[model samples]
Target chain A: GAGVSQSPSNKVTEKGKDVELRCDPISGHTALYWYRQSLGQGLEFLIYFQGNSAPDKSGLPSDRFSAERTGGSVSTLTIQRTQQEDSAVYLCASSNAGGSTQQYFGPGTRLTVT
Target chain B: EDKVVQSPLSLVVHEGDTVTLNCSYEVTNFRSLLWYKQEKKAPTFLFMLTSSGIEKKSGRLSSILDKKELFSILNITATQTGDSAIYLCAVLFSNTGKLIFGQGTTLQVKP
Candidate 1:
């Protein structure tokens, strides 16, 4: 793809429901990132994937938040027992190199937990 | 913890007016600073400044980095309505490949 791509542009789920968001990064990009943005708030880093190394999950908010990158290309973010506060736009970005590389973002997935 | 701060949370300007957005950061092992323009959805890249005292420009948009001051400024000359968007600033940490972003400055240009 020419740029990063995300699935389910919008999702509305009830409380306690689980939701999965997918991301497809640009070809040959080795680094990928996931971020969450609440209404009127800045982006919050969630996770980062670099090659086959263990993902940097330091930013994951809680145990209910988990993500996985397959083949180092496509990634999935899963939220278990979603809460109303979990409603936000989930953004995915990818970069060609590791450090100081420019990131290209995908049209985020807007999740609304009712 | 790395932190990035942007001033003037929101601004409203008329077309052809010039505007400057500010960003400051405190990060360990700072490597680069990036600016992005975000509309309703995805954020589009604008400029990336690595070296101090150097300026990056594209069309009516220009940005300069001052490593000594730990800050950067984005300037838009003769702005247009299309230029209205949230301007975001981010700093990349060396080796860690982590990018910490500041709360964006929202610009609204009226025609």
Candidate 2:
């Protein structure tokens, strides 16, 4: 893909329901990252994947938040038993390398937990 | 803990006016600072400052980093209504490949 792409641009779910958001990173990019933006808040780091290495899950806010990247190309963010506070824009980005490399972001999925 | 702070949480400016947004950070092993522009959805990358005192320019936008001061500034000269958006600052830590973002400065440009 020319840029990072996300699925289901918008999602509305009832509290306690599980929701999955997907991201397809650009071809050949080795680094993928997920971030959450709450209402009037900054981007919060969620997780990152690099090749087949153990993902850096230090940013996952709670046990209910989980993510996985397969084949280093696509990634999914899952929230179990979602809460109203989970309503926010979930963003995904990928970089050719990492650190100082520029990250390309996808059109985020706006999740509205009711 | 790593942290990034942006000033002037929100600003309202008239078209043709100049504005400056500030971002300061405290992090371990800082590698680079990035500037992004956010409208309704995605945040588009603008500039990445790696070295100190070097200015990066794009059209009416310019940014400079002061590593010694642990801060960076984004400046817009002769702004337009199209420039109305939230400006975000993020710092990338060395070896970690993680980004810590500031709360962002919301700029509202009126014609």
Tell me the TM-score of each prediction against the true structure: 0.98, 0.98
CAPRI verdict (incorrect, acceptable, medium, high) for model 1: high
Could you give the interface RMSD of candidate 1 in angstroms? 1.0
Please give the range of 10 consecutive residues that has the lowest summed lDDT in model 2 chain B: B91-100
DockQ of candidate 1? 0.80
Candidate 2 lDDT, tens digit per residue, A1-114? 388899989999999999999999999999999999999999999998988889999999999999999877899999999999999999999998876598989999999999
Tell me how many clashing residue pairs each candidate has.
Answer: 0, 0
Provide the lowest-lDDT 10-residue window in model 1 chain B: B92-101
- Highest DockQ among the candidates is held by which one? 2
Query: Over 4 Å off in model 2, which ranges?
Result: none
Predicted candidate 1 versus true structure: per-residue lDDT over A1-114, tens digit per residue:
378899999999999999999999999999999999999878888999999888889899999999999888999999999999999999999998877689999999999999
Any runs in candidate 1 off by more than 4 Å, and if so which? none
- Per-residue lDDT for B8-111 in model 1, tens only? 89999999999999999998899999999999989989999999998999999999999999999999999999998999999987876677899999999999
Where does model 2 sit among the CAPRI classes?
high
Tens digits of lDDT, candidate 2, B1-111: 789999999999999999999999999899999999999888999999999999999999999999999999999999999999999999998987789999999999999
